[model samples]
Target chain A: MTSTTAPVDASTTNRTVRLASRPTGEPSAENFRIADEPLPTPGDGEVLLRTIYLSLDPYMRGRMSDAESYAAPVPVDGVMEGGTVCEVVESRSEALEPGDIVLAYGGWQTYVVAPANQVRRLDPTRAPISTAVGVLGMPGFTAYAGLLEIGKPQAGETVVVAAASGPVGSAVGQIAMVKGARAVGIAGGPEKCAHVKDELGFDAVIDHRDPEFKAKLKEATPDGIDVYFENVGGKVFDAVLPRMNTYGRIPLCGLVSQYNLTRLPDGPNRVPSVMQRILTKSLTVRGFIQNEFVKAHYKQFQADMAQWIADGAVRYREDVVEGLDNAPEAFLGMLRGTNFGKLVIQVGADPTQSA
Target chain B: MTSTTAPVDASTTNRTVRLASRPTGEPSAENFRIADEPLPTPGDGEVLLRTIYLSLDPYMRGRMSDAESYAAPVPVDGVMEGGTVCEVVESRSEALEPGDIVLAYGGWQTYVVAPANQVRRLDPTRAPISTAVGVLGMPGFTAYAGLLEIGKPQAGETVVVAAASGPVGSAVGQIAMVKGARAVGIAGGPEKCAHVKDELGFDAVIDHRDPEFKAKLKEATPDGIDVYFENVGGKVFDAVLPRMNTYGRIPLCGLVSQYNLTRLPDGPNRVPSVMQRILTKSLTVRGFIQNEFVKAHYKQFQADMAQWIADGAVRYREDVVEGLDNAPEAFLGMLRGTNFGKLVIQVGADPTQSA
Candidate 1:
């Protein structure tokens, strides 16, 4: 292996954003604490990585809460956990070298010392390194595996996805289209809806904010929905549910809308009605996290997604936040539907983009 | 061809129960109008049958209302629709001979004419002819298909079913035991619970009516539930939900508890919470009607269920309400959970029982 490079930063410190406290409702800046610590020294077979991009996803909100989940919650005082595209600044492993761009769980930090084996090296020439945290990463695999394995959208069937301008939903819609299924997207505003339909090639896009959103969704999906990629659950799910055709399949990936809520909304508990609907329609609602299907579908997803990107069959958009300091606000904005596309925090300089 | 047998009924008229009006909540005697019409002649390819037993099931409640469902609702003033075990009194087709025992959708009528091709002949020698609508029929098939196809209870896993003394739930629990999975039954009364545990051979039984019902269920399913055959969906479901293990499969067949309710229960709408639990646990909640799998698994079900019954590995119970006039009350009682096991209206003389 090439000799390890000296620390590149003039400041011999690493900055991190830690979870100061768990939020009761929507997370605020008070929930996070930014601090500087001595630069971590790499142990044997470990690499020091400088964060280039930090993914801000809806699932991150789940990690912030202490609720029971598929994965453990990010503890208070711990560095806010997230996927990151990093550049290996110093390496002490045969597997990685200095200046190697790799994918790592570097979180909301300027630097992370990760075992070399834990990070997968990214070839910058193949694609922009930022994609290691966006279109070609966890979110993309989430769309691929959940949609295909659970949703199983058949050709000519309608597949509806909410948050259609975001990473997972955008990929879900595009992949549904790839499988010859009609892709109807649900996004918040006119701009995002337009991006979803025109730029992303979705057959139809509904503005969930519009008063006539449900009507528009109904009009868009004339034959009824066969597959629903459920990343957003709240009013959008309420609207899409009645339109589900017999034997419809819903891949429940995330409940982004419910994540921030302090308590359940008052109601005549509609669980019975929902269960009745499922019974009558013979619907399949399966919840899954991306990690469950990684072993079976990750390689295929990479190859197929790469080909789709190259063939112009699948397109993606990125909403890049400028710095680590802006990550909390950007993440909050994402939860509030202010951000569009794959929301990413550009924590540091991107060498690949510069090239 | 065998000669046609004279109509066995003493009266020249067909006595029928018609849906007089839709029930607002609980069905009453007034909802059913018992009427008589002149015996009709069989047309070509039709056979006139004297109903022996009419299957009174939870699904018939759905057919009572005008609500949209998989099958059309029974129109007011129309003969109440049901599955029937019948004896052919008159045959106008070569496929069926007079005195042949057959299964048909003969509705809640003493005597009716049905197309010969639409009915399947049942040999009384193989088992009791009433088994066509009980242990060997729709409810049995429902338990088989929903459990194996959707619930997919793996060996050593826990499989739970409500209404455990009833046809569907009893079969579901027994079949789980046959598959080397632990079977946990939830029933209302101590007698039914005892029957479920001692007679049906379920691994454990919980009395759903007990004050400590939920606690008992939790204790019974220490390993957590992997498969839940959901036929009774109100409080039992609420109790079962928290006990579901990660990747738990729920094959939703019916909502017997909620069937008679006029409106949803007051709540901080729990739909979001349910969806959240589903997402976090990677649960599979599927709604299915037994007929969905009839095409794919019917033959196998027939062979397997028959063998299991013959081997004494599966046991069943029938709550037979004698006389056609008692059917309306019996059906209503079934919705109230008063009837134990498979509720059947003994419409006419059972020739097979005599044999």
Candidate 2:
């Protein structure tokens, strides 16, 4: 394989979704703008990538707002930020060649030009190419590192995670199972709950939409929760907190339930009560971004996760929304817990997957 | 010295302070009752301890209530629980002899018969015997383990602690300084603020009672707080949360401010926002009791603290009340931040002190 750059053709163009405006509470379609522009040329040490699949996540809702976060928010009229699986169309670097599939932060766009070193090459023979943006990518690593490092689920301990049908939470539960911990999942609907319990192989699954959500959570975790992979905050947190055992751990990665919240809820400011619980229970509540562990754990995560997938110890589902045009609606649906699995936008046709 | 048992005299009586009633909010004189009981004799492998100094701490306030906590609540009409420095009046084991000073959980009584192995003997030649209940014992060890193990103060980083003039906070600041970190202290009044800054040698000290406390805290931690030894919670926590640096750690030891609260305060529950801050800043908030680190870090703590005290890098002050009869009053004062330093009742004469 050799690096090659194709001549810029006037017929080729890039379609992109940009942030039109910031949302107040829940985002509407008016917050996004679809535009078409001429394809970018590959520079020295860079590769021109055509996006195959764009991931839609709850964290993107956070990136839409200008609130203080671990990552910078997408600016108005800028390409909405996200992870994507792309194919190298034109390369000017020795590290990557034309037709090579790679995982890149090409965001909500049909095409991108990135440094070859910045994008990681994905071998299509090992797994589906789309899994690069789902199970074998950032979301999977988020669950892997946060659960193992902060949550530290010991054998026979109960590990609970909400959004069990989604990428991060699904992986959290399954990986906890792999480590000999009893994985209890909390999902919003009966179908998702069943999938999480039957297919994902979690020890227990509770439907968060049930009126007895708290009681169900309590029932599911009879021995009490030792590790809670906190992805969805709000009432789920309220339910899980009291069920936490002594010396329990909370690996806080995302709070999707509160991401759309315009303001804090009315109450007696229960932060102190939470602090009181943390003190009396000897709990550890740690917030982390998965990237913090990449330098140390990414290689190990890839190897262990690959093995788990091979042995059928781990399973993942993808809710693929067709076309770049459907991304905005799909993303909104994901925030509302409508998406069933690792939600991704099939931006363009995949060459590796046989039709 | 040899193990010996004193003859129990029929005329000798033990004076005790028992929990008459549980306090709803602030404990009062009515909550405690002073009584006389017959002296207990030492059994085989047991020793009789005559309370010389009774330590008054904020945690005792929690034990007074029937609320669920890390430790069980004191039973109604039971002896008020506390740590005490005692003189072994009779020993039936080879570990201790008569007149040997030891640290014991003797409660609010003048004398207690405990298993000889349970009490820890203190060397008066190394430090003051009263220190067994203060700087050289539990309080100091709490500061050492919580700060070093959990807080993990790094060189040139800023470390903040509240109740700076009190036993735990004072040692926390000094140890942070010993670790080459900048120490910021928060205390209630001018006297304590002065002592924390001038005498205890904190890098900076703030008067928490000041109307501009939040502003002062921000001003004190110019580079932002890398480690916060959370000894006081409530408004102090609210102020410190915004000032925490990314990847900061909080060793949650005590919530002195909320110990007496009968009910939670009103309006706009901020637990989510606190979680949001934790997420954005990648913060670690862990709660712990000092005894958790006893097996792993206590020996190192003793060696390191002894050297620091010897090298003049650490200093402590004790506010001794004249009699056990004054303990309830002194304890009430300590809760209100009226009593400075480590509050203790001199139950009997300290023969080791050359007075």
TM-score against native, each model: 0.97, 0.97
TM-score of 2: 0.97
Clashes of each: 0, 0
Tens-digit per-residue lDDT, A1-355, candidate 1: 1111344453577888888889999888888887777899999999999999999988889888888888899999999999999999999999999999999998999999999999999999998788878889999999999999999989999999998999999999999999999999999888998898789989999998899888898999999999999988989998899999999999999988889889889988999999999999999999998999999889999999999999999898999999887888898899999998899999989988754
TM-score of chain B of 1: 0.96
Enumerate residue pairs that collide in model 1: none
The sequence of per-residue lDDT tens digits that candidate 1 reaches over residues B233-291 is: 98888888888999999999999888878989999899998999899899999999988
Cα lDDT tens digits, model 2, A1-355, are 1111343332397878999999999998889988778999999999999999998888899889998888899999999999999999999999999999999999988899999999999999999998887888889999999999999999999999999989999999999999999999999888998999999989999998899888888888999999999999989998899989999999999999988888889988888889999999999999999989999999999999999999999899999999888888888888888899999999888999888
Q: Residue by residue across B235-264, what tens digits does model 2's lDDT show?
A: 999999999999999999999999888888
For candidate 1, the per-residue lDDT at A68 reads 84
- Residue pairs with backbone atoms closer than 3 Å in model 2 (clashes): none
How close is chain A of candidate 1 to the true chain A, as a TM-score?
0.96
For every prediction, compared with the true complex, DockQ reads 0.85, 0.79
